[model samples]
Target: MNRSETFMEPENFVTFELVVHGFLVLIIGTIGIIGNIFCLLVLCRPSMRNSINCLFIGLAFIDILLILSAFVMFSLPAFQVYVERKFMWNVIDVYQYTTPFVYPIAMITQTASVYMTLTIALERYLVVCLPLKSRSICTYGRAKRCVFTVIIFSTSYNVTRFLEYSFETFVIDEERGITVTFLQSTDLRENPLYISIYINWLYMVFMCLVPFSVLFLVNLRIAWGIRQARMERSRISSSQRNEESLAIMLMVIVFIFIACNTPAMISNIMETFQIQAVKLTQISNLLIVFNSSISIFIYTTFSRKFRRILLQVWHRKRPEDDVLFRWKAEGGPNLTGNRSTRTISARRGARVLTATTSLEFQREISS
Candidate 1:
């Protein structure tokens, strides 16, 4: 395990690997770009602009960047045709020359996306579990600042990546003068200590374990808060219900992160232990990409506001019949036109509970 390790290029093209990775890159990248863009469009709306939505927009933006970068990284090699080997080799050469730069951007964007998700979970946890404190802590201004800090931290932190990896050309055969391009780590090529610490400790512990653990625990608190509020129906105002729904969506996203990212995390750890995990790493990478790509679907499915806004943007038609919730900072009762206010007094004998939206009031009245 103390010995230096490096990635060496294969002498011959592994058709299966190229095909599989290419397919994943093509499919996932296309889906991710489209979905993230749609989410961006929906969340960017003034109605959706808020502290939590700010984090989501940041996450979507980072995910899009990561996906597009990964797409180019994976798809470049898939175009290798026997007849066009010369042309493709030139393409590979260009990619290899750019690997040092591209890898850092990918790493930084991926890290930012993860932090953004964690920030989101933290925001939801506070909003659901500690509503009053969250008001001050989870302001839109604060969220924007947090996102900027995350980007700065991720970018600055991953600067070490430039020192870690480089593209090296290796001669596989001298008779035909066959050469292959490889992405090798300088630290791994010269000093094994760096990767041992970087991957095993910094990446496994700080990047993977700590974040996931915090997300899991925070989401658990959010869920518990929701359950407790539901048990005492009167404590659950329309705004609180909205918080609960948002919490559920956040929890689902965290679950997907754990599910999609666990394999890659484990693979990195396994490699650190000197277990041969190249295939596992490749598969895990696909899952990681997929995890990043598929989040928009979760947002669209779980958030009605997201869907309505999407439809509004797409069709240029407002479906007024579709129920909408307009959350207000201050709770009050107001009546205008056909809209009416409804109150559900808390069983604990609280004085009044106000609905967050006209739609919720109408529904409660009808029910």
Candidate 2:
């Protein structure tokens, strides 16, 4: 078999690619963009402020860029064909011009997204398994630094991707007054040394193997920590329980990342072996798009606090309502329970005072 020979895909595969990469990506990407915007709004609120949520905000922003770039690179091309078939406006030329830039951005953001998830998992692992050290290690300053580092590394790693393609323009039909511009692969992209060292070995190790192995082990440790805490549930504090909840939520996110990313990882490995896996590659792209789009749903489903803040934002409710809601959620005084009204009011007042003090303490620590 010729290692460089193109594989001929079956007709069904074409249809599958068109539907999955075209319409499905369009729908999912649209929803993902809007959902991530909402996620940003919710995460940015004062009540949601924390190191983890700060990382989440960064992740959401990266996902937005990833989805948008995928839409332009993959979805718009599909639409371009559809427009040609229907003889519609040639707006698809937009993709032709934007792809060179968007392609590298997408690659950078996807790389950043993977590492950011890993960072979140590692942070959670520290918080859950080594609570004492996490106080100093997982501060907001460190989280921001981690994010900035990931962005820098991702961009630096993908700098070659930006240089891999060059754009050119030509007249296709002089009589019809038609011209087209498209990306052409540069020699660097075709160089065997570059391909072997950077594309195959470096990419597989850094993007695939390292992250997958670390996340798997860290998540297992986190699960063990949560289980140990649960066994001593009666002795655990409310804050500990909240930590477990957050850890579980992050575990779900990591699991989804592994699942969605496994196909792409497999495709990459197969390609490294000179195997033709075009269909798998297409499917992997769709899954990656889906992965980038699903975080908001995960956050809302796993976090009551997130949902409460979302509702508060939507309803424009008072800040006191949030404090009261949190107090109640933490097993505060029950206004309608068997307790007498005076006793309930007194307990409620005390709880409110405690909550206020805790909030102030958190503010001081955060500052």
Candidate 3:
């Protein structure tokens, strides 16, 4: 990889590339809006759903915010030119001060989302594997506290890097009217203005290693919890239903985590092993884009209800301005002629269906 590798764009780079990239961005942004908003709706519904989904819903919302915030860079005219260039590192993209904000914002948002996933995993692990004591430790209040803790810790993890970016460690050069920033491996040799290896190690550990370690252990425990649930509930408890719900959600997050971070891991490992490969770095960088892009798919897979609600919300006209909730009333009887149906709200345990709510409610209540 040469520092002077000039990347030339096609003759109609701005026109064709912008059209394609803009459409792609709009589609992703639309899905992000719908998915995150729908997750928020599901979280706000009632005690049961909220209790289980508060962390996940928050995660969904953060992922949504990450995608939305990325539009700032993606929408900028520089993005068109940056992507057109062959080398991302050589391109003059975001402003220097903006790097302090944008880079950490992206990293922290990602870290926070994964932290929430870890919390969700641990919660499921305890509930499934140690049901007796889980009740004592994993209450809704405790879960809420954990959510706050993740936000705090992960946000702090990225903030440290943001501070480092401002210390004049990086050298900015103007090449062919393009400002390029080089993130040198180190700047603390004979002449040291501010950069140090200790600081670089700090960046590596927090920005990469610790978060990776946490995600691995958390996802592993989630798998263990899933297996334990299947074994323990095989006889009569019918724990598959519960395990399926939690597993799908956690698995989606874990998969996305892997997709987003695997490239970076490979590059980092190559460096650790003293192997040289620029292709690996390029591949990993591409994965970062995929990591950000695949979030909508994750939502669709983990949450069937989220998918349904998102479709409805997207198709519905003036949904944001509307107030009244109109649901399909799942499991409602398909009535025959000569019988009109009217649904009315009622207090708990009260009859709302022709004075004849079916036995399903009874079965649930008894169970």
TM-score against truth, every candidate? 0.76, 0.83, 0.62
Query: What ranking of all candidate models by lDDT puts the best one first?
Result: 2, 1, 3
lDDT of candidates 1 onward, in order: 0.69, 0.80, 0.53
Task: Report per-prediction Cα RMSD to one decimal.
Answer: 8.6, 5.6, 8.1
Ten contiguous residues minimizing lDDT sum, candidate 2: 1-10
**Which candidate achieves the best TM-score against the true structure?**
2
Candidate 3: 10-residue stretch with minimal lDDT: 358-367
- lDDT digits (tens) for residues 1-367 of candidate 3: 0011112544354444344334555565566666566656645433224334667666766777666555543434335464645344455444433554565676677667656766776776666567689769866677678878988887876655565444244335545454545433223322233323423454457546776677677677767776765677656443346445656566666767766677666666665455665445544543444455564566566555455545555676333222122222432333442334322222211332323333212211001
Candidate 1: residue 111 lDDT (0-100):
83
As a TM-score, model 1 comes out at 0.76
Query: Across residues 146-262, which tens digit of lDDT does each residue of candidate 2 receive?
Result: 999999999999998888778878999999989987767789988999998988888899989999999999999999999888887768765776788889888999999999999
